[model samples]
Target: MPALPTAALQLAGFLMAHAFWTASDLPPGGHYQPQSLCMRADGNRVLNSFDGTNPKEQDEAARAFVTGGAAQWPDCAIARQVKVGTPTGDVDALVIDVVQYGGSVMTVVQAFRPADKGFRLLGDELMLGDNGPLPPLPAAQAAAAMREGALDHPGMDGKWNQWETERDPVSPLVER
Candidate 1:
């Protein structure tokens, strides 16, 4: 086993960790599962799974990422007591759940807005997996697949069986 790529970016200029409130916390939709980062990406709604089983869900997701989607949306915000992870912090370990549709092999999404000061739409912050046409796996399996290249092991399970497969939509889509 090796240190997750997140550790490599502790001092990364792009690092924007909010905080760690809890483990196994679920996001808005049933699809986006809870992890270290509550991000603005497609599978974020897919519950961390880059699956396209539900087109309606994914469509809303795709537009969101391309058009400054979710990050711009504002709901009556609730503060989560997140333990912001840092390279020099007391937290010995870190895990950034990468989830993007058409970017790197590490599952990351691009988060930004049209104007530097305007609100972004939550829908525009999400994009489903790209690169190769693929299917969705259960949430647990999705997390495992994300760890493939970056880990000594990169494997996932199907509905009820362990599976070995290639990971794509691994990185976040780069904006122009």
Candidate 2:
């Protein structure tokens, strides 16, 4: 059988996780609202989907979320791929670059694998700027960084705030 598109599978897993987390409503401190899914020009949906007044309006909002309803640069794309050695095994990693019109670009590095009837998000890092085509680091170095919890880099700060977000529970690329 053919494998599913990596991007779609990963996004679906992410959306599912978001849904699970929101529904669980753990910690009970902050407001947790479910997100809405909308397709983008690149055939991908917005990461932060939200509820809209109506289905049609929600669709429009999703479209506008990516384009701002104005002529802009093309949608996001998978800039590059890299291989990393994880505890489970060697896996393919992807670097996704999203360009926001009239705003800064957001880069995401994530490692995923097909699991639990879908996909599992092993590790992810978000950063600002167009840092496409990031070369894969040496396996030894990558493993060391993962062990040391050294995922964030200096001078890469932006609104997304890599430092603020929690790191993945497990190091997907680190071989035990």
Candidate 3:
């Protein structure tokens, strides 16, 4: 069997951890549901949702959501921030490196947009190698690659199964 990259392992760990965390942290009167990760056209931000009700609030909420999830892993820390050009425009991303566990440097990339309150989390990626600056591919191309990769890999399916099984059994919210 081939060994998975450190970043891939870290991403899988994050998904598993997130499943458990979200299951326990369901919103008041809301069912437990995991949000889909999304990247903006500019590639500067990714989000679970942006209903446009309140951009600032939404951004802050996303940041808190990511921060809380990342905090669960004591070994992970922000490595650096970089700006990448996208089809829409340039965006900033945070590179988080997880050390002390797998013995290899694992990096997760997160992008954020500035809000009135502060910076809000936009999205993240699990980088496997020295892929240079993230948002490495253009937004559309990156999204397509992600879709293709998820569809092509049985590992992704296994990860989803693990996420579902390890999570608490509660009704999930209907996606809009």
Model 2: how far residue 59 lies from native, Å: 28
lDDT measured at residue 77 in model 2 versus the true structure, 0 to 100: 25
| Candidate with best lDDT | 2
Model 2: how far is 95 from its true place, Å? 2.3
lDDT of 3 by residue, 63-102 (tens): 4444454443323322333455766676544443433332
Worst ten in a row by lDDT for model 2: 151-160
lDDT of 2 by residue, 1-176 (tens): 12213433234234334433333333422222324333365754544543466544544554454445322433322223345675556764444333333242343455644323233445544222344432444322323332232222222333123322433565465434
Candidate 1 regions off by >4 Å? 1-104, 114-117, 124-130, 138-176
Task: Report how far residue 149 has shifted in candidate 1, in Å.
Answer: 19
Q: What TM-score does structure 2 among the candidates reach? A: 0.29
Global Cα RMSD, each model: 18.7, 13.4, 15.0
The TM-scores of all predictions, comma-separated, are 0.18, 0.29, 0.29
Stretches off by above 4 angstroms in model 2 are 1-82, 85-89, 101-104, 115-118, 126-168, 173-176
lDDT values for all models? 0.25, 0.38, 0.37
Winner on TM-score between 1 and 2 is 2
Q: Write the per-residue lDDT of candidate 1 for residues 1-176, one digit (tens) a residue.
A: 22223322221111212211121132422222122222332312111222246634454444334334223322111111112233434221122323222222232332321222231211111222344322333223433433332232112113112111211232223223
